[model samples]
Target chain A: MEIVRPTLLLDKETCLRNIARMAEKAKAKNLDFCPHFKTHQSAIIGEWFREFGISAITVSSVQMAQYFARNGWTDITIALPVNILEIDQINQLASGINLNLLVENKESLVFLDKFIKFQAGIYIEIDTGYNRTGVAAHKTNLVDGLLEIVKNNKLLDFKGFLSHTGHTYQASSRHDIFNHHFDALLKMRSLKNRYKKDWPNLKLSLGDTPSASICDNFDGIDELRPGNFIFYDLMQYKLGTCKFEDIALRLVCPVIARHASRNEVIIYGGAIHTSKDSIINIDGKELYGQVIINQNGQKILLDERNYLHKLSQEHGIIKVTYKDFNSFKVGDLVEIVPVHSCLTANLMGSYLTSDGEYIPTIRQA
Target chain B: MEIVRPTLLLDKETCLRNIARMAEKAKAKNLDFCPHFKTHQSAIIGEWFREFGISAITVSSVQMAQYFARNGWTDITIALPVNILEIDQINQLASGINLNLLVENKESLVFLDKFIKFQAGIYIEIDTGYNRTGVAAHKTNLVDGLLEIVKNNKLLDFKGFLSHTGHTYQASSRHDIFNHHFDALLKMRSLKNRYKKDWPNLKLSLGDTPSASICDNFDGIDELRPGNFIFYDLMQYKLGTCKFEDIALRLVCPVIARHASRNEVIIYGGAIHTSKDSIINIDGKELYGQVIINQNGQKILLDERNYLHKLSQEHGIIKVTYKDFNSFKVGDLVEIVPVHSCLTANLMGSYLTSDGEYIPTIRQA
Candidate 1:
């Protein structure tokens, strides 16, 4: 395919393999593989999950849930804390599909209980040290208040406790990741143990790509909703969650100019295409992306010395070594493995498969 | 008028005032105001510039140039370095509009010389300490080679040196901003003096909001092309380039959840909505955005104690002060002044004016 601008290229085979591995792992452990559609956000890509007998999916917002629902996804869970203002949309979806909503506070439940008319499964989002959102796992009194509101509301069905071990992403080492995951598992299990007596068949849902990719001990967790695993990025690779080859998405950008004086190459890709998500490199500076040159029918991954160093609105400045700098010229397409695939994918809206098919995402939908 | 999701709120009066102030500044100095449209990529907003007699405009890509061209903008400069791969589009745009393109190297001119079919203006992008993209001002031999090619090519009109003093954004003080701007002025002046004998009507264009907003001196420059000043952000505010009141855009996001124990609020806005641009706060941590509580129909700017601290794919964690924390609850819409307006504006694709009208940007177009 002739890529003139910054286009996200998805390797279908690699993406399928990633799905198969995660799906197989979940099946072996007998855990529900309700992978988060927020990562791919594409209906066509969501259909790929069906090959592994996966019928349920997890989205991040009401709009995403609506998007997937329209695409024939019946059983879906919105993992984001319920925005009571979107109760109208929630009711619309809940009336048709088996929509599950997440609630972390009694206020959300109070609001949802008052406004929601259709049956919707409710998951009390339990905090397992992520501290971004969710009720603390230890706060059973608060959980009781929320569950009481759920019990009082005929439309709301208490599903179980849900936690995203997002703290695993900040792990300094694999040992740290395991420790964070294990601690979260214990907290989630404690909540399940306390509540499962009254709500038997309550399912524990845990998410975050780092924990799901590395941890095998899902003893009490019933479902996994790891999103970024489907399109593993440089951030995941840095965290040792996935191998470099497992990453399926690449941003193909055209080289516009080369500055040999500073050993830099300017590409059409920038914050607009890559979304400015960065990781610290060995030099202790921000590394925007890992650069790979696609030239002469060969893809050559440049060394750590040659990486995307800076980004503006519509310009990506790649700091390259002298040896690699001369290899690049204007009009060549260079593939960038973004620091965060989810954000990059969201920015691009659609992806061009390696075979040259336009796969529209939730943004386009 | 009712916003349930993360919406970019544009205050039309504030935005128009910003445009008038910049236009007046350019007029007072007798400098041509060809403001960069990369920030507010809306054709409707672009029309606002016409009131101030801004007929010429600057864009960062060929697609953006084409978008503006279709919207009736005749004199357009694609401020990005010429991508030889898009010669076909360049030829098409040049044939219809008074198109101008930036070229930093002889190779681009050589390629343009070979393929360009219609009359096009060429600006040799000069590196005036901003080593992102541009030829060094002192490199007269290299400049001569580029000019030689432009002189030989009948279609490529030589439009003198253009420098984006973007390094002014990194200035620690207003003095530093002046120093950076003055240094660029000196360098650009040197280039103009050396080349004016050959090309009498050559023009020097300067860009970047920091330099344009604060620096009063534009002695040697012929045109100014600042974009971000149109939507002055927290970054511009922090740099002492613009007042907080000058910021015209805000990401109005609904509060989904609030945790009192840690004094944190989770907004529906995330990396997807805000684009992850951050400014280091006084606390010496990454501050994603400054929060303004829009409760009870009154706007209250929360102190530095409360700020957006973290962002994930679909979540934004705002660290709030204990005193202000109680004022927030589920479903309250909070306004966040973004660190960088351009990226946030690009991600949002469209804006809802304070009067409740949808303003579509280039992303939406």
Candidate 2:
């Protein structure tokens, strides 16, 4: 609470605005807004979504689903392809709540069919350009195989096709994001058209912050589950998805040392606090994070040259410009805009709200 | 204990051997072995060093110092530049134990001189080429000013010059590592020679796993404080510091999906478990970790092409060769040799020993 070490400061106002904007976008499009809880991972923040008429939630793992289910969230979906090894825990969660699981292959479906004792919704994970996971959208045969097993099991309920357009994160421009999202939409729509006769009530779910924030075409998307929008970071800003002011988190670290000869400032934050997530700057060097000096009630964002350059276990070296080197001193509290807020939030395990209240996340809970 | 999720498996026999080897190296050279505990921030692992006559320990932060001190480690050195903001905790630790803090500038010494209530040893951090922190070794005037403040304070005991040649991690070859270590040695020795007359007993401390593992030069060095040698990783292997067998830790993750079209295997282990630390492989691609499949009572290290290629929040995409693709199946547990063990260990918070014992790290403790 005293801010002696590197602490993540969460601006409650910015986060509430982010949540409201995303919820409004989903409402206008008539889409079920099942925002992913993987970013914030806090039950308190999840409770804030209830005021916007949001009930359903999405998580990346079964452990997260159980955590939210215990907190009174009934409708939950585990977004990752189901790890069959965790079927026991999945079965336990399904027995209590309306749980949905993602399956990309028949192996996981067969395992679920044989082991699950309670009713669980199954969403076929379709790969639409994002080759991270999921079945290829064109591969209807694999989809038919997975559905056949689900149809035979009375405890399994067929939901719909789910896809994560993660490749939008690599978009070089707004045009690139639009093009990738359109291509993915076509692929997902083709599958929906082919299976509409058998599954008339099926839903299509798509997620990823880039396309969800920038692209306006949610032609066939039934639900939106963009997680990082809750705390848009430098990566989202670089991808043209969010503005700098939308970033709701900043790592507050104390400047421990200042080296004028080399024009560097050392801070207590490092790779352990902010994971080694970086972006290539204009100078073709790895920029870990942007620095901001809040002095005299004014927040001054340092120039491009004064960024977090190197990180060790507990030491972050910021390459300060000659013009800004004298502005820092020992024990000065500096703020670093993290490149990826999700990883930083995961590492810090908890957050200090703008009003100084402690918000405990899943890691602590 | 069931290990259904991504769990770090520690081979205790390998860790014990690593501890003995580094302790023997320090003994053979008559150097005081104060091994760095930042790599394995475990009180259980700290107890392992006691069997090898390692009484003094080195840590990276005041919190780690307190954690070890609570675990009965009397003598400890926080190897990072002193964060004057934590003067209260520093004073508390110094009052109870033999604590030493690293200082690079005069401001922190002045802070310590004014507020420290108990005797605390001081190490003047000298920059020998690692431009991350510390004063330049040749800057005698800066060193004089820092010592002047320490000499005037009765509670501060001047230990000596300490150098962390961390630049050796970027060495092109073992010869380059030797050159960097030798250059750092000359600079530290120069400072010691100039100050030996004023302070009769000043010990030169040096650390860095690359130099401690490969370079056979310990002339004029009194203490060795390398940490990562306790659990050698893929980065150390690439640096020619240790063999694959010496890597004691592995993230054992369950295989969730296998895509034959992309020749990729998606595992439950990901950036959250492995910490996105990578090295460029021979094919000019990022290699996150090496894949090792332990099936049918045999461990097989896949080829370079089958390395863990991509990482998401909770998913790892391992690009497998055609020959190695068929060997994997859904629900099979595979091991990933992490890129940087320290970050991985810190992220995991706990470890599962090969003998099925649970070991809690500092983050857990």
Per-model TM values vs. the true structure = 0.98, 0.99
Distance from true position, residue B116, model 2, in Å? 1.6
User: Candidate 1, residues A199-266: lDDT per residue as tens digits?
Assistant: 99899999899989989999989999999999999999999999999999999899988988789999
Candidate 2 lDDT by residue in tens digits, A1-365: 69999999999999999999999999999999999999999999999899999999999998899999999999999999999999889989988999999999888888888899999999999999889889899889988888888888899999999999999998898899999999989998898899889989889999999998988889887999999999999999999999999999999999999988789899999999997989998789999899999778899998889999899889999998899998899989999999999999999999999999999888888
Positional deviation of B65 in candidate 2, in angstroms? 1.1
Q: Evaluate residue B272 in candidate 2 and report its C-alpha lDDT on the 0 to 100 scale.
A: 84
Docking class for model 1 is high
Point out where model 2 deviates above 4 Å.
Answer: none
| Model 2 residue A221 CA deviation in Å | 1.8
Which candidate ranks first by lDDT, i.e. highest? 2
Residue-level lDDT for B148 in candidate 1: 85
lDDT of 1 at B176: 94
TM-score of chain A of each: 0.98, 0.99
